[model samples]
Target: MLTGLKTVSKKQKDQFEKEGYLIIKGLFSKQEIAEIDQTFMEMSKKTIKGCFEPIMDQSSEVEDPLKRYPRMMHPHRVNDVAMKYMLHPKVMLILSDLFNENALAAQSMFYFKPPLARGQALHQDNFYLKVEPGTCIAAWTAVDKADLENGTLLVVPKTNNDEIYCPELADSKESFTNQYVKVPKGLKAVPAIMNQGDVLFFNGNLIHGSYRNKTKDRFRKAFICHYAGESTTKISGFYSPLFREDGSKVEPELNPDSGPCGNEFDTVYPH
Candidate 1:
């Protein structure tokens, strides 16, 4: 167990428990965010197979900027910096406090919400991760200032413990991803405005997503990761070989349940 880690306080833990999400201001330093920016900026110029496949040619037939700079999936498996943040001790410590047990690093993603990029639809993380016994927790680090204009994340408070609802087809005009989860009655989705270096941690079942980048120049870039507790016995095969805080691999049993829609949209979509 990690000792003497002062990242998460008792009040913060209680807030997360009560609201289903918590935002830690400046959880990552400005220097750290700059490093991430430089790394991904360099990466955007080339293709890394299944990780990142940005199109360098702007004159190509693909018009969408996201097609040119798609969200990088499982980036930690390829980039040293991404892996460093995925298992960053401070994040691991806070996750331990939230789970009340050791945490396992399961997945990492970097979103380059460039100008004119479409936002992801509201959906649950476990709907895709399929962590059994408990749900995954997402640590979303905003690399740039996030607001409604630049497509900041949105969440429905107190929806953490709700059962996974089958998703409906999303409006392609607004969302890049096809899956969309409807907010339950009496619940409303609210924007999570954050500054650079801030990290938002939310439950796996939280109904959350963002709107299209309504601004002309700003890009709402973010570094996001998902984790499961040490006791997790199964997880989706896509995120297999979960890692420990020490960087050791642990292969949990594969979870085959793909929610109500089967695996039609299983291919990596914006998240």
Candidate 2:
């Protein structure tokens, strides 16, 4: 085990149990944040022309004249520094607890929220992940300061265990469809504001999304990691590239040699 792993105290764990999410402040150092930001900016500048226009039209309703220029999906494998942060020890500790053992990285994404960008539709991670309930998590780390002005994430309290609900899709050309988790009647959701280097860990079933960035110049950059427990199984119609411990792709099928899945790790977590 890595020394000085950021363990979640009882209070923090309780908060997560109640709200379906928790924020760890300053999980990354300022120097680390700066390096990631620099890497992102450089990559953004290089890929900007080829990416921006198409993604904007697909993911948001912002018109060309009103949209803020933003970048999406920087490949992490291309950057060693990014890959290090993705597998950081502190992160792995929390994930191990959630998954009740060693976990595998299911997906990684880099989201850059520039000024005037529209908020993402409120939805759960499992909507796209298609994994068993409570078997996955999303670790969202801020490379730059995130707040209301810069499109910080907003989440409904205590809504994780509920069955998923379909959200009203805003008129957009986005490729992925969004379905929000149902919120209880008369309850208001809260916005989660995070400073640079902070990481927000939430259940894959949590209902969350961000508000549009209304700030003039600030940019909110977040690196997100999605991980699944050893017992996690694939849902039909949703696909993820499964990998073994050595990172080689596993063949599609369930068998003794196919690795663990379908409640195999139910007792792995120590109560």
Candidate 3:
């Protein structure tokens, strides 16, 4: 058995190790969540070049709501609010316990799963990160109420030990991303319903994704960040310039040249 948590309950740590994921309730206070909401809501109106490029024409109709407001990648590189929360002390503490060492932040993403938009297909994080020996972990914070109807995250429990499988083409009608990892027989997808301020931390190899948003009024927004343990030696170049918990940066050895997501192409899923 592993040592108990430092700041979390033994049950929480046990669940994370056994199920490969844990949901920490109200990890951020109301005021903090409000600030995060306000910051990203305002950012949604503008684009930040390489970090976030949204369709400026609000009236230009497109079939995909993602085209109007695509997911913001690496917002911490451009926005202080994003950076502040990305290295949140409480999150860092939990991560330290999980990794049994310091946690290094790799990437931050703001997903605006607007109403009628598609969800990301089920996939493994290591397939993209390619962390050597050890793997990455994710802290997914919900900025809005997320539920099954709105297409919140769906995780397949006990799959964290599975190898990264070759992804198949996803159905474009439902998934925003093109690649998908098929669910093994005998396992089931469980909805990870989260309120604003709640965070779900999961292993890199977890089989997880979401379905298309069917809600007409509610939008599921999330701030997700990836991290590698202190013991990690190499990772994908795309996640270069990792960060320490104190807002400082660290550069790890880059993984050997290879396909972006374990596939034959270097093309990454824009979602």
> What TM-score would each prediction reach against the true structure?
0.93, 0.77, 0.92
Candidate achieving higher lDDT, 2 or 3:
3
Summed backbone clashes in each candidate are 0, 1, 0
Tens digits of per-residue lDDT, candidate 1, 1-271, equal: 4465457788998889887999999877899899999998887778998789776788641467777877888889999988989998878988988999999999998899988788888888889899988899999999999999999999999899899999999877778788899999999999999999999999998899999998878889999999999999998888888999889999989887433112223354322
Candidate 2, TM-score vs. the true structure?
0.77
Q: Residue 270 in candidate 2 has what lDDT?
A: 15
TM-score winner: 1
Q: For candidate 3, lDDT tens digit of each residue in 1-271?
A: 1243236678888888899899988888789988998999899887788777777675642566777877888899899999988888888889988888899998898988988888888889888898877888999999998999899999999998898888898877778777899999999989999999899999999999999889888889999999999888899888878899888888888886523332212235332
Residues 1-271 of candidate 2: C-alpha lDDT, one tens digit per residue: 5688787888988787777888999988999888878877676555344233333343453453123344343244456666666667788778776556666666556777766666665677665556653546789998888887888888887777766665564433321223334456876679888899999998877888776777877777888877776666563222245433345543233212111111111112111
Q: Report the C-alpha displacement of residue 117, candidate 3, in angstroms.
A: 0.5
**Candidate 2 regions off by >4 Å?**
48-71, 171-182, 235-239, 242-271
Q: Which prediction has the highest lDDT against the true structure?
A: 1
Clashes of 1: 0
| Least accurate 10 contiguous residues by lDDT in model 2 | 257-266
- The weakest ten consecutive residues by lDDT in model 1 span 257-266
